[model samples]
Target: MTRTLYLFGSAAPPVFDVARVIEDAQSGGWDVCLGLTPTAADWLGEGLDGLAALTGHPVRSSYKRPGDPDVWPAADAVLVAPATFNTINAWALGLTDRFIVGVVAEGIGKGIPLAVMPCVNAAYVQHRAFERSVRELREMGVTVLYGEGGFVPNLPGQGRKEAYPWDLALTAMDDLVPKREA
Candidate 1:
């Protein structure tokens, strides 16, 4: 049985590498379904169709119409990489204005294994809410990789897109929900 991974992304510079990340997850035996925040979808405009094709499911950035049949299979695990400060705080505060945040917030109550790797800068990290939000998510049983061993914040205006640790999030997700033996 193939494991399904709901890979959701926020609008961070690292989101530009999401195609490669999806491929990596697929190689690791995950049937990936991609979801994006509204801004992230806008940022990936013109390439959204390509992402949908790559994931074998629609790249959802908005809530589906009520009563609409679900498009993707049930998720066995979820990874929200490049989670922005807004997304992290919004999720912790239960503010579900964005599709990705809404789903991941619900994933918590649904008891779905979830992990997040924040892509924030040092300036953003100084905000009081940022640390509180990370703690709240961790207290909620979410695997948040945001410190020394995971994604250390870079200086503002000095982000190293190439250095974003996508592997750390993937590895943590794999640990949380191991792939089933076929």
Candidate 2:
């Protein structure tokens, strides 16, 4: 069975990088579901159509569609790359404002492993609430992949001294999938 991976996050520089990661995962034969934050959708452009083409699955951004009876597939794992500080806090507090949060909450309830790659400003990253939320997520058994540095826009030499490798992210997602018994 192909493992379902739910990708969620905010609009940051690493979002482009995250797209590459998703492409790699698709090439590796994983079924991918993308849920973008409003801000993320804006930055990503093309309204997930490109992502849908890449993954061959419908990319969901909202939960307000009427008569959309297709049940979201149970995810084998959840990856929140380029996770904004706002998203981190919302997830930590169980806020279900959007499709991404709803799916993540559902996955957590089902005990699915969740991997979060946080990319935000240094000030926000050091905020007490953000720090506390990170601790809480860790306690909840979510694997937090810490990205180095903030995603500053239009600033030369100011973001991610070493960006998280796409392959490493894919490997982490693969690790969450259970090996089938032969």
Candidate 3:
């Protein structure tokens, strides 16, 4: 069975070209489902439709009305790239204010494999709350790709979106949810 991966993006510099990640994951055999934070969705501008086309499902940013049918397939795993400080903290707090957060919170509860690559600046990583949140998520079985050997924080004004490791997120998801060989 082809594994479905829900790729969630936050409002960070790397999100603008997140399609590259989707394409690479597709090549790796993930049936990608795109979802974005509201800010990320707005930042995408006209690229939203193209992203929906790329993933073959609507890029959901808001919760659909109750009773609405789910358009995307059941996710076998989730990858949150460009996970901002707010998203990391919010998710840890179990805040389901947005569709992205809702999915993440539920994914955690359901024991769905999850990988998060935070794209925060160096200063934010030093915050006590952020540090605690990362540790808490790690305790909850989240594959947080942060710090050394993962996503190194960039300087405040010198974000190297080009260096963001989208591939690593997929690799972590693979570690969590092994693909079934046909």
Candidate 4:
């Protein structure tokens, strides 16, 4: 079976540059599954449809459809980029109200590799709860990229001055791609 990577995050940057990331994964012979938070879908506008088309798979946002065969993919790794404070806290606490968090919780529990890229203000990042959560996730073996050491809104053409590592988001996927079975 093809290794699957679950993409989770909020839609902040208008040009989040996800197409190339998806294409790269496909080229690596891995299946891509996308899960968008409600706020993310709103910010993405029509970009969500474009992502679905690119991956040839429907993007999931909620956990209401548990019986759907396609609700969750057999992901080999889960990458939560542009991960909002709310999403991070929710996932850390094991609240699976949304599809993305649900799948992440499931994946982690099942021993699948997981990576998180938190995208929130530095103040929020320093919160004790957030710190504890990050530590807990690490203890659970999840790779938390922890944004680029500060808080910055995701905007295109802003250079690499922001705290978030947009480029590393894709690079993390490269790290997660499974080796072909001999």
The TM-score values for the models, in the order shown, are 0.98, 0.83, 0.97, 0.80
Candidate 3: the clashing residue pairs are none
What's the best-to-worst order under lDDT?
A: 1, 3, 2, 4
Candidate 2 wrong stretches, greater than 4 Å: 64-67, 147-157, 160-162, 178-182
Name the top lDDT candidate.
1
| Consecutive 10-residue window with the lowest summed lDDT within model 4 | 154-163
lDDT of 3 by residue, 54-143 (tens): 989998999988999999899999989889999999999998898998998998889998889999999998899999999989999898
In candidate 1, list every pair of residues with a backbone clash: none
Higher-ranked by TM-score: 1 or 3: 1
Question: How does candidate 2 fare on TM-score?
Answer: 0.83
- Quality of model 2 by C-alpha lDDT: 0.72
Query: What is the per-residue lDDT of model 1 for residues 1-182, given as tens digits with 9 covering 90 to 100?
Result: 78999999999999999999999999999999999998999999999999999999999999999999999999999999889999999999999989889999999999999999999999999999999999999999999998988999999999988999999899998899888877
Candidate 3, residue 57: lDDT: 91
Question: Tens digits of per-residue lDDT for model 2 on 1-182?
Answer: 57778887677667766557777777766778787888887777774787877767677667857876765576778888777788889889989987787777677768999988777666676579988888888888888766443223223346662554445566777777754443
Judging by TM-score, tell me the better candidate of 2 and 3.
3
Q: What lDDT tens digits, residue by residue, belong to model 4 across residues 1-103? A: 5777887767555226566667876777668877788877776668788899888787777775456565546777888877777877888899987878887
lDDT assessment of candidate 3: 0.90
RMSD of 3: 0.9
What clash count goes with each model? 0, 0, 0, 0
Best by TM-score: 1
* Predicted structure 4: lDDT: 0.72
